[model samples]
Target: MASVQHPFPPLLSQDSADIERWLLALNDVYASDEVALIRKACEFAAPLYHDEVDVTGASLLQHALGSASILIGLHMDHETIAATALHAVPNHLQDWREVLTTRFGANVTRLVAGISDMERLRHFSELREAAIADKQEAAQQVEGLRKMLLAMVEDIRVVLIKLAERTQTLRNLSSASPDTQQHIAQETRSIFGPLANRLGVWQLKWELEDLSLRYLEPLLYKKVAKLLDERRVDREKYIADIVAQLQSALAAQGIKGEVNGRPKHIHSIINKMKRKQMEFSELYDIRAVRVQVKDVENCYAALSVVHELWPAIHSEFDDYIANPKPNGYQSLHTAVLGPRDLAVEVQIRTPQMHHDSELGVAAHWRYKENKQSESGFDEKIAWLRQILAWKAELADSGEMKEQFKNELLQDRVYVFTPQGKVIDLPKGATPVDFAYVVHTDLGHRTRGAKLDGSIAPLNTKLQTGQRVEILTAKQGGPSRDWLSPKLGFLQSARSRAKVRHWFSEQNVDDSIAQGRALLDRELVRVGVTDINQEKLAQKLKFNKLDDLLASLGRGEITPRRVSLAIGQEAPVNAPRASTQTIATSDGNVVIEGVGNLVSRTAKCCSPTKGDEIIGYVTRDRGITIHRRDCPFMQRVPEEREDRLLEARWVAKTN
Candidate 1:
């Protein structure tokens, strides 16, 4: 028998030096025990990932190490690093869960599980890209997917790990096939890059964007790169000279600050060029420097020194410190004419502002999302970003772990359609609610649903990340049971309203039919079968025949009244009800042929003044008045009809 070929690539030989270097990179931040735990995780993953290569044709172990390194650059905690190292364990090891939990601990296991859960979304991302034809629709789907990714994980660190893994994959994407490269690059640019930007992980965000652009728009990427390289040496020299000049000026003024040249990213350059429709040379921020001060006072002092050193471009200044960006980014941005009359952009801010702009929820998310106000979810995201910003400082206190597990956006659940589109709903939303959200027609025809490939009840509370496939009929309407509050069929108000509207429409049609039947019977009995219904409806003060019929069917109009309106004498055989009217002295209800009896508005219907009312005689409580059209009143049994009495509201005299 021939040897069976495995679907995956052969495992590459292990390298001990690679493991040593990875641990060495973390030695400064992690204590010895923590480092040892991370080392053990790497060692455990090494043999398991033996010879198996990822899509990029890199060994799984190398890929894991690369991802871990990215997270380390983000200053993530030890558990995040370890989880990154073991992210692929579930794919290679069946007992991975128990093994990871037993050896590495529960937190690491949970993080690995989260990574694995997120990995499943890759196929959906591809599907979404292929399914959406409209650019605007595709953009909306991408935004939903980004939120879904965040809402899916309990630990925000899992998202950081996922971002790190994507960054690493892009780093080694050159080895992949052309088609694979394009797909990966596009996904990174659309999804992961924005996620990184939102998390304020500028370290990974910049690399992700630059690398993705390098593949997605190769020609443009090279053009920007070449333009920057052509002036690389000169720009570096110019920025360095400006930085030294600013440092000297600030020092001379006795203001303590640190000045450094800021590297311009190719993607951002391209973005600005396209956004402002300006050439690379016209961009003011291409050769930029940042000044970090100790306090707000020092920030203004540094800004003053920079402006005094170079003539300021009044139009190019932004006082973000006083009026910060929506994402909590605070900095003073200004453009000044530097040496040789070159435009030099400078940003001045305190250290805290600098940290926030780089590692907190800065302007990147708002810039990409293009949303003006912060939603509840965005508020929670801000909290998550704060945790990341404080992770390093809180690492020794062990509070980072607790903070990492704090679930956010729990009020919303994000589910996927069969076609891979993400649908966001309120938490506890059911499959029926999902259907309604997708389309009202779909919701009306929805008969069953399959959640994650298995049949689930229509009322099954959908969870985040589940792929829901609604089984719809060819022709149908929604069920009344969906409107029942106790059934849990719908949790969203929008969906519930849709179901109610469907039923109300059906009821209106039925009422019209019933009204027509009753009116026809009355017309025949009164010997006026030849009368025109349209004219009769107009005589009865109804704008439409259907409206007249609906009123009659709903018992809002009596057959005797219709006969009288049509100029027919009442038949002696017809039941003779009291026609007496009683006016109350206090502008309260007046029951015909009844007086001196206590009456109270029914709480169920709350019939108020000016409402057509009916008195339902209770045993102890004199009479419970209800609206004539109230649902409960309509359902009153025939045996109780004798106890009911005609009632009307009498307006008070001025």
Candidate 2:
């Protein structure tokens, strides 16, 4: 056979190289009339292949083609890719419409225009704030736009492909500046990543998380990467040896099984360290091995073989073959001493179980992963998709990707209840959290708990497979003690809010009653009786007298304080002083002997001249006349009460 060779040019000299490649690939599938369209599309995409502008990077063509591969893998068509490449075509320095229309006909032009409008969104802050303030409106807008795009062209392939192109451009622009990287990653994490994850596009979701994590927490990302990289060779070797030993042991026991291994991701290892407060050296279960076999009989046979080969750790042995997690995770897990006495964990399951283990959450997402399994979780998982969808789409949107990333990166522990029901929680979940998960009533009344038939505190952190039994009382409710900053937050937001709600309702009632009494006393001090005050308050536009009373009752105003308040506002000519002298009532004043000043009363106090009088001689001013009974005169008393003379006021000023 003769070999045919095609000539290719280096990127340095290849003019229209990308367009040429696209046409060649398109030529394979299309007929003559369609081939004419492919040539036209090449002419349209030609400018993007230029050496200096869009073609600045040698990798540009590869990135665009790679993005196209992702779209095609996701089930997109040529029309979609054609629209997508046009979508990324920049028109910042030129009239974008004329350029787009001049190249591809209006179909590609219109789709690109819609994406361009969304990207050209002005006042990013205001739009973000509005979305936050009115989530329903924002949700409506999201669905509306999505529907519009779908309705405009019944081909969703085009928009997805365009979005994929945008994602690639973002990845390219990331290296330009840290700020650019951060902005692009934030957009992807907030918007694109969640959208992709919801649609079950895990390949895109994972790349987006890693890229976002790289820029968002660069140090953390690098630390994790470095830690993983450092341990990579040893980890690979350890798991490989463990798997090899397990398979050999199983084969010798006449049990056929397939063995494989997986190492924990860096994020998961870091999380376990943070959660359990352990040094990196103390991490257990960092590497795990799986033995997949024929049936439940072989599964146990493999387990027995594993146990015989290595000394089994009784405490770490998990018999999920008998009881599986609620999420349908089923397997026989056991930790044992492998070659050289190294601690190695082994999991035994059937081929069906092996598939379930890999496709845990995807059992419901893509229907293909939903095969019949020993664990009955696939049915329950379908129900969770709606709940998880909101979590991905709405509730705290910017954190959606981070939360998803963390959930993936964090470790899980499976626990159990007295009745053999399985409960899966985060590694450090406590009994109170479990109590809440059981029932709201039980959570509120939970005073203590019993773990594995032994008494434990409500805050006791549950270990995997430990049976929890909560102790409650008829009269008891949640203690303030349960809301511990140290123990852990009961992760159920409903549970936490219910506990707070009980305390808040009590405080509100107490404050209202206490405020009323304090304010009522204030109004009584003033001679404006409660009845008269009602009339005054009505004139003041209070809906009812209690409103005025309550306002006063609340210490917001005082009756004595009101006197000073009213007096300060009155005119100078008004009778500002009260008619009666406002002092402790008694006619007799305590004063000493001084008759001359008592005979002619002092004008200052309006004291009667003949009234009980006393003389208070002033500095360099003699014999200021006053009634002895006057309060100020009485304040500085003289020798005899009998000699204290009275003074009467003479109308001097008038």
Candidate 3:
């Protein structure tokens, strides 16, 4: 494990001074509680760990204990922190067992053992002993095994510890191997961040993004950080002025709320830069003051006062209050020029809403704490689920960017249904998406729409604060043309899946009809046509004849090959024996091969009146028509001579 080429550099290696400082801070806070855990975690990890401070597991263990203390609401003893240090190593299972037994006895060892996932199994792999025939397959196997091992563990603490360790590894890895650093950063951006996001850990979510950005896009990260640093003086001044003016204005209206100013994070700044395609100077919302009032009404009252105090930027107002976002985010936002001509952003919301917005649901969870927990945080996770539904397809784009932008991008519009139901959609979402948001069936059946009480087409783009009315019909459904790429909203995976499902059902019906008609034509061509065709299907090893026809219709079954297998003679003018079945208004026509077959114009080559022709009988499908000397037709059914059916086509019936 200590070899130079080992996968992950030992956790405790390097950055000794930083680790010592952080440990000292934790000790100052928790005293013996932190000190005891720190020593025990190091000692337990000692046998597997390297003596050099760089390879020690103490730092990762300490961070794990710190995070678990917050998450599980537990003051960790030596045993818990020791367990954290070893969570990444299954090689030292005996050491962990002994430590658990000495500190917290049998129960802790069981907990520790439950999380041992054989991460070191590669050392024993027989496949490794043999030359790995395919490197691509081996990497997939490694990831598959890792996921399986993690899923097997019941205690979430193992997962939490591993999460911290991975983050630390990713952070250190960037400087060690730029390629692996970037690759692992992307993996974290994709899998770990989403897991943290799903778990409602907004703090971890932000850290994942922030750390990944730092590694994968270092220049951009540095630029954003430098820009923030340069503007720190201006930012503090801007928000302070906004707070003064807002408080005075609220006092004028006899309204009171808690107003605090906070700066946007560095990653958020970089995102604004990339999405807006603007320099740092162009972004106005560097420092925004937030207002958390006692109730929803006061939130709006405070907003009105703030607007009255500073001349509002007319086009830069968002009223998420009356029309909350689909994710249940409700806030009033406005940018205004404050004292000294500084542009300041103001956000007003209820206190509870402010908490939910920041933690996004992590603020409240009814976990196994003795104390009663909260509920709305769990509901906020429901918002994450909705976002995930939209995001799943982006995984393949090989870019975490769209997720970053979509999660952080601020431009939005709030509209209302005619019944006063608020709909929060992206700025450019058309009435079609609005209809789907109302109900998918409404989207499928939408006839026309009314925007601001005026008739409009279904493609009408919604504006903030406008009233929308959807006109639907029982006789209508989505147009096939709506699936065109130009219809932006319907192009989303959810909408595409629904529309595709509908059309697939339609195709099934069409295929069934086509299959039946082809069966009818082929059976009628034979002398015993009126007899039970079901028994013929059984004779051909088909449970249902329709399946055989469909196979013929879809080109899965070659009629000429079927004929040759059953010893039927092929037609002279029938289309050349091939898999492709040509469709017609009369329905699909194919060769039936289970019984004696006949000669007809081959559907594949559709022989003209005076042209030389030949016919071939198929074992499964009906007779196939072909040109007289076509090489493909002559090639099928090389041996069977007695199964041939005689057939001739008369002059056109019409």
* TM-scores for the candidates: 0.71, 0.39, 0.46
Tens-place lDDT digits, model 2, residues 75-156: 3444545655555565532676777777666766776676554443312222442444576754543432332222233223
Q: Which candidate is the best by TM-score?
A: 1
* Reference-based lDDT, residue 98, model 1: 95
The model with the greater TM-score, 1 or 3, is 1
Q: What is the C-alpha lDDT of each candidate?
A: 0.75, 0.53, 0.54
Error of 3 at 73 (Å): 9.3
TM-score-superior candidate, 1 or 2:
1
Model 1, residue 282: C-alpha shift (Å) = 1.2
Off by over 4 Å in 1: 1-13, 24-26, 361-410, 507-509, 512-654
lDDT of 1 by residue, 490-544 (tens): 7887887786566556678886886888888867654454566788788779998
Give the residue spans of candidate 2 off by over 4 A.
Answer: 1-15, 18-43, 48-63, 72-80, 89-174, 249-279, 282-285, 288-654
2 against 3, candidate with superior TM-score: 3
lDDT of 3 by residue, 124-150 (tens): 222332344676654443433333333
Lowest lDDT 10-residue stretch of candidate 3 = 1-10
C-alpha lDDT of candidate 1 relative to the true structure: 0.75
